[model samples]
Target: MSVWAAVLALIIERVWGYPDRVYRILSHPVVWMGWVIGKGDETFNKPDETSFETGRLVGAVCLGAFLALVLVVTQPVARLFSALPGGWVFEAAVASSFLAQKSLGEAVARVAAALREGPIEAAREAVSHIVGRDTAGLDEAEISRAAIETLAENASDGVVAPLFYLVLFGLPGIAVYKAINTADSMIGHTSDRYRAFGWAAAKLDDVANFIPARLTALLIALAARWIPGAVPGGALRTARRDSIRHASPNAGWPEAALAGALGFGLGGPRAYKGEVLDLPAMGDGRRELDADDIDRALTLYRRLLDVLLGATVACAVVVWVV
Candidate 1:
């Protein structure tokens, strides 16, 4: 069943993330998706060639077709796998590629480690790999905050959202979510070239993530109860009070929760593309964060994954029995 497949996929991802040598050989599922999306951009998204409305219309149609194509391929494959004995395990391995538990955690853990022992530039460089914001001028606190924010937001985007879809619709569901999320990342931007051409991808990705974002906030709040020095109530309270005030519809939920749980202030005035964005601060806690805060965040994230895995197993049992 799909529920059990979700459990196996989580365990597999936690134990062994996509290996580097394998990535060298196969690149990644997202990379392949990115290639197709790039082709779409190149063929039709001509800024000077097409009008704004034309671009929007074309993007919408292309997005619809891309999603349709994903479902067409993945749905049949899922059915074929279900027909074979122990095939769900093979499907689980395929599904594991869609999860980012180890990858995101390892990346954030490296940032924390670099911040603790390495030079300021090392810390900045590590943080830059995860966040899109300008890291050149970041101080210790800003760098630490950026790292934690990325871990928190990606806990939802990279892990929770994909798993959510996997549980609901098996391999096909997860494939569709990843395709949309990848399309959004590749082309969904506010730049002059992307603003109109990527409208559908941007909006659809938001719609897909809406529930999972809040669910991640709730899960973080739950996991915070078990993490030493984390405040579950504060996480819940801040998420409720400040999540909507964030610049993005979904990112604020988990960011505010993590900030409150760790008693650190985050998300206030960051530079992007050399332009300063005076974003609203998430939690009203201590503004001066250090490497220790990043460590606490990593611990919380690990604990959250444990909680998520246990819940997935429980759901699998329920689905099997029913």
Candidate 2:
């Protein structure tokens, strides 16, 4: 039943992403998590007074409390759903909220559409919504790279990771994963204020994502076999060769795989807060990316989603038979 819930969640999220009206009315679960994280920061992180060591200790405690709250809230809901007739439908809806397949595709597609229809500023503005890098001065190649990289990375964390947990431990698994991921997104950074206080969250997020990230690369590699002009062998080779070069242990796997599949260079000399990060370039291909490149990446991404769904359905079938 939980396996079926994972299947249905992917289908529902594919058909209709999270609704704006529902978001307006109840806000989002991630938003609620963010609010809690914010409160934790305000209450415990008095930057002017707390020492670095104390901040790290407090951060671990806060993360423990936040995860406890997530489990407490979700466990009852899961049990209630389990007891109800056709309860997996409701469970599927809730689980769908955690996956971002529809939203991420639409957002990245918008960047391509913007580049096609409007000024570079429009593309930059659209890309800004998805990526954290400074987009103000990005050219067409950079914008295309940013959109593709985002598609690859988010495909791992936002879609695969949540679904992985949901399939393994049902609603509670996904809820806990999302809580930890959201906390990391909110507080995990290198800024002086959050550096110490967010250490626990950042490390935990890395641990949680390690497996899913690699799985995502493998899925992308498999997906490439069907996409014209995509290279599955290249994806595997580049992922093996270049993924380790990234600063983040998990992000590079998918990014490098995507780069290799599409034959586009990525992860080179990105600037954040005026500091240049000359990360090693992945893939031995063209560096001058364009709108066509974005379109190709989106095509590959959509294909990857189909593969993921097909794989999920197959798993559910096997479970049913067993």
Top candidate by lDDT:
2
Clashing pairs in 1: none
TM-score, cand. 1 vs. native? 0.98
Q: For each candidate, what is the lDDT?
A: 0.92, 0.93
TM-score of 2: 0.98
For each candidate, give its TM-score against the true structure.
0.98, 0.98
Candidate 1 lDDT, 173-198, residue by residue in tens: 99999999999988899999999999
Model 1 clash tally? 0
- Candidate 1 stretches with Cα past 4 Å from truth are none
